[model samples]
Target: MTPADLTCTVLGAVRRAVEEGALGGAVAVPDRVKVERPRPGGSGDYATNAALRLAREARLPAREVAEVLSAELTRHPGIAGVEITGPGFLNITLAHGSRDALVRDTLTNILTSGSGYGQGRALSGQAVELRHRAEVRAAVTADAVRRLLEAQGALVRIDAYEDEAAGPVPAPTPAPGPAPTATLAYEPSPVPAGATAHELHRRFGTDATRWALLRAAAHDRPRLDDGLLVQKESNPFFLVRYAHARSRALVRAATRLGFTAGYEEDAAALGDHPALLAALGDHPAVLASAARLRAPDRVARHLETTAEAFLGFQHTVLPVGDEKPSAAHRSRLALAEAAGTVLAGGLSLLGISAPEYL
Candidate 1:
C-alpha cells in the first residue's frame, strides 16, 4: 500500500483501539499520523511513532500502546506484518498483493487525475488570505504557496503589500463555508540585489527563475547563480526536468517497440523497485504536508527525490537491444509514466514547466 494508505490504516487502528477501550477513551486520535521510510538498520517497509505520540493520553507505556495497535493492525488485509521497534515505533510491511495494488492505484490515480494527481481535500472549506511584500522572491514564494493551498482545497487570496503598516486586513467571511483560518502577511527573505522580477525573468527565464526561488525554504536566501540555468547533473533543477523528459522518452521508445504501459499484478514480475515505488506512493502525502505547512520547498524537495529515484530506475523500463518486450517492461513503463505525471504536476504547482524535452 501507499504511504498515505498506510497512514490511514494506522490511524484507523488507533481509532479502533480507542473505541474498544484498548487505548482507553481518553486517548484522542490525531487528524493524521506520519508514516515514513524506516531508518537505517530499521526493519519493515515503513515506520511510525504513533504509539509514542499517544502514550500519555493512553496512560500506558509507549510499547504497550504499540502492542495494542499492532494487534489491530495485523488484522488488516493489506498489512503482512507490524513490528514494534525501539521506544514503540511501528515498523510495517505490506502484503505482496498490497504492494502490487499500490502500483496499480498510484498509476491509475496519476493517469486519471493528470495534472491534479496530488491535489487533496485536507484543507477543504478553509479560507486563507496571504499578503506578501512587494519583492520578487516574496511574490514568487507566495504564489507557489497559494497554488499549494488551493490544491488542498483552500480558498486562497493573495496580493502584494508595499508597506508593513498595512497590517492584516480583516477578511470577510467566505460564502457558506468555514471561516478564514488566519490572515497571514508573508514576508520571505528578499532576493539578492540584481535579482529583480524582470531581471530574473530575462536572465533565467520563467522555469529556472521559479525553480531557483522555490527550491529553497522561504526564510533562506536563494541561489540565483548561472548554475540554475546549467543543463547538467550538478543542477537539481535540470535533473528534475530531465528525469521527466526521460520518462516520456521511454514511453515513446516503448510505443515504437509495439508495446504500451501496463500494470502487473505480480510483484515479483515487476522486479525490485521498492525505492521508486515508495517515492511514487509518497507523493500524495508530500503534497498534503506541503500544503498544510505552507512550504512549497517540501514539494520541490519531494520532486527532486522522486526524480532521482525515477532516473536511477529508468534504464530498466524498456528492453535493451533485441531483448523481447514482456509484461515486466510494460509494468516498468507504467511506473515511469506515473513518475512523469507526478513530476509534471509538482512543477505545475511550483509555477514551473516539465517540458517533454529538457
Candidate 2:
C-alpha cells in the first residue's frame, strides 16, 4: 500500500475505535491523519500521532488511545505490525510480501499518470490575476506563478506592465543617413545590466537559468553565478536532472539485460530502503503545497531529496558483474523509475526541463 492508503487505513481504525466504544463515543475523528516516515532509530515503514491527537477528546491517556487504535490497525491487511511508543505514536511496518507489490503498483501508477500524476483541483473554479512590473525578475516570477496556478486548475491571467497598450504619443525618427547593404544578423534579446537572469541564460542555457531564477524565495535575490553551472553535489539542479537521467539509463540497461521491472517475493528489499519510499510517497503533497504557497522552490528542494534517496538506493537496483537479473533487481528498478517520474514532474512544475541525458 502507498503511504496515502496507509493513512486511510489508520483513519478508519480510529473511526472504528470510536464507534466500538474502545475510546468512547465522545472522541471525534480528526479531519486528517498525518502519516510520515519514522525518525532515525524508529522501527517502522510509517508512523502516525493519531492517538496523541485524539487523547484529549477521548478523555484518556495518549498511550491508552494508541493501544486501542493499534489493536484495530494490526488486524488490517498489509500491516504486519503496529507499535505504540513514546506517549502515543503508531509505528507501522508493512507485511514483507506487501512491500514489493506496493512499489510495483506505485511505479505503475506514476508511469500511467505521466506528468499529470500529482496534479489536483485545489484551486478549481478560481480566477487569479497575477500582476507584476516590467522588470525581468518580476516577469520571470509571474510566468512561473502562472504555470503553478494553472496546474491547480486556477484560471490565471498574467497582467504585466510591459504587455499593456501604450497611450498615443509622437514617434521618434532616426536621422537620415546612407542606406546600408542588406544583411541578416542574429541579435539576442537585451537584458538589464547586472541582471542575473539573462547572464545565466546566456551561460547555462534555459533549464539551468530558469531553475536558478525560480529556486529561490521570490523575495530573496537569486544567486546567479557559475556556481549553478557546476556539475557536482553542491548544485541541486544538476543533481535532480542527473538523477532523472540515471533512472532512464537504468531502464535501458535493464531492457538489454533481458529483464523488466516486475513484482517479486524477494523484492521486499525495497522496504529496507525507507528513504526512497518516503520521498516518492510524499511527492503529491509537495506538489500541492508548492501550488498553494505559490512557491516553486518547494518542488526544487523536493527533487533534491528524491535525488539523494535514489543515489543511496542506486547500488541496490542493479546486479554486479556476472550476477544474473532477478525479481528483486526488477522491483528495485521499478522504485528507481518511480523516483525519476517524481523528479521530472516536479521539475516541469518549476518550468525546468528534466532531460533524459544530463
Global lDDT of each candidate: 0.82, 0.75
Candidate 1 local lDDT, 1-358, one digit each (tens)? 7777788999999999998999887878899997888887678889999999999987999999999999999999999999888999999988988877777887888888988997877877777777677677777777787788878878777766653211233333233356656655444454443456778778888788888888888767788888988889679999999999999999999999999988855777654777777777778888998988888899999999999999889989889988999888888898899999999999999988889986
lDDT of 2: 0.75
Minimum summed lDDT over a 10-residue window in model 1 is located at 164-173
Q: Best candidate per TM-score, number?
A: 1
Cα deviation at 280, candidate 2, in Å, is 1.8
The weakest ten consecutive residues by lDDT in model 2 span 164-173
Q: How many residue pairs collide in each prediction?
A: 0, 0
The alpha-carbon RMSD values of the candidates against the true structure, listed in the order shown, are: 4.1, 11.5
Encode model 2's per-residue lDDT on 106-217: one tens digit a residue.
6777877877777767766565666665455556666666677667766666555553111111121221233323322211112322464445567877787777767777
Instruction: Return the TM-score for each candidate structure.
Output: 0.88, 0.80
